[model samples]
Target: MRIIFLGTSAGRPTKARNVTSIALKLPDPANGFWLIDCGEGTQHRLLSSKLKLNRLERILITHLHGDHIYGLPGLLTSRSYFDGAGPLQIYGPIGIRAYLEGVFEHSGVHLEYELDFIEIDSTGIIAQDDGFIVEAAPLEHRMPSYGYRITELPQPGHLDLTKLAELKVPPGPLYGRLKRGEDVKLAGGVIIRSSDVVGPSVPGRIVTILGDTKPCGNAVILAQGADLLVHEATFGAGMEEKAEAYGHSTVLQAAEIAAKAGVRQLLLTHFSSRFDDEAVEKLTADAQTIFPDTVAARDYLEIHVPRMGSNASSV
Candidate 1:
């Protein structure tokens, strides 16, 4: 999977950054995009990119802050302008229904497709299916907030065709059966074990995307053993007091959470407009003191979220 950051600024937009939005592009665009937080001008941000509106399948909002949610109405409506001829499933905190209902009513804009809502008022296993899961946890923002976690399902290891060929195992339905963990029995009564032909099962990848929050225990809990943590580092290390006062995290605090959570990679976003490019770099450098893989993100940045054990080849 890949993450495309549409916007990554905090509370406000700057010339270099827009507000908050992230896209988890699935193989099937019609299945829609898994969007996180539709900050103001989010649809416009997509206009500059290769993303299409009709592909937005699911939207997960972490909070009700304007910067995090203001783009929903416009995006949902603007979707009609594109080929969004189907329904959109939106997951967010409580009052999302009323909020969207009000916005559509106030603007006298009725949509052309379906609008389904899931109000996430608590933290738990918020979404799950055959392939993946999305969980939620409360965050210490001034208003009610949440952090989301995405876990992709494990995959079956690749079949070692060379092993089968070496064993004179003719490629046929028997190979398919063996790949599904069944021992293949040849008409000659030769039995081949699946273990000899397949490696271990592929492990799933864990990703935690945090909303605006302070250095709270919940952050660490949600981020445990994550492959990638998209967290908010709104301030520098020396500004911890300001960070706390504003209910946000400094670079050091974010790093400490990543370190404690044993995360493999840390990607920072939602930066305060106060810090410019150079300052954000300095802030990430400080975070690396606690976790070396820490990086501060910018708008339109592309990050490859590898499926677990793809390169390492370990389950």
Candidate 2:
């Protein structure tokens, strides 16, 4: 899996950054991509990236803040013209459905595809498929906000070829059945147990993406043991008081959460527009003091999240 940051600025846009949008691209291209947040100019940003509107499968909104959802209506409208005819699922807070319906009605816009809005009221497992499961939890934000934890399903282990060879098993449909953990009896009346020839199942990977929030317990719970933790660092170290007052987190607080969660890697984003590149670097350095694997996300940056036990790195 990979992550593409479309916008990284907080509250408003800057010369270098737009706002807060992220694209979580699954390993299978057929599954398309899931968008985390849709900040202003998000569709414009997508124009410059390799992602396509028609391939967008699902959208997961963090909050209703302008910086997080202003681009949603425009993007959805534009999708109609872009051959985005497949059914799309959207998950967000209670008002999300009303918000979109109101926009579409007032603007007299019609969509060519089906839109499924799944409004989230409580926290727990929000969505699940054969490949992955998504869980949501409340966060400490000025308004109602949430964080998402996505977990890939565990995969079957490889078949033990050497053991099969030792048993004089010929490669055929029986091998396929054995690989699927089925016991098969050979023509000679010898039964082979799949458990004796298959390795342990591979563990799935976890990724946590949080909305704008102050340091909170739910953040830690959502991010615990995640392969990648995306948290907002809207202020530098000395601005803790301002961050708290505004329902945001400073770089230090973000790093502390990453440390407590024991995540494999921390990605800091949603930077305040007041900080320039130099100031952002300084904040990242401060965060590294607490969590060495912290990365300051930038617009257009692509991060590759490998499988569990593999090192996650930026492209």
| lDDT scores in order | 0.86, 0.94
Cα lDDT of candidate 1 equals 0.86
Distance from true position, residue 98, model 1, in Å? 0.9
Model 2 regions more than 4 Å off? 166-176, 185-190
Clash number for every model?
5, 0
For 220-300, candidate 1 gives per-residue lDDT tens digits of 989999898999988888888898888999889999999999998999999999999999999888889889998778888
Tens digits of per-residue lDDT for model 2, 134-167:
9999999899999999999987788899999999
Candidate 1, poorest ten consecutive residues by summed lDDT: 306-315
Model 1 CA lDDT for position 196? 88
How many backbone clashes can be found in candidate 1? 5
Give candidate 1's error at residue 271 in angstroms. 1.0
Clashing pairs in 2: none
- Top of the candidates by TM-score: 2
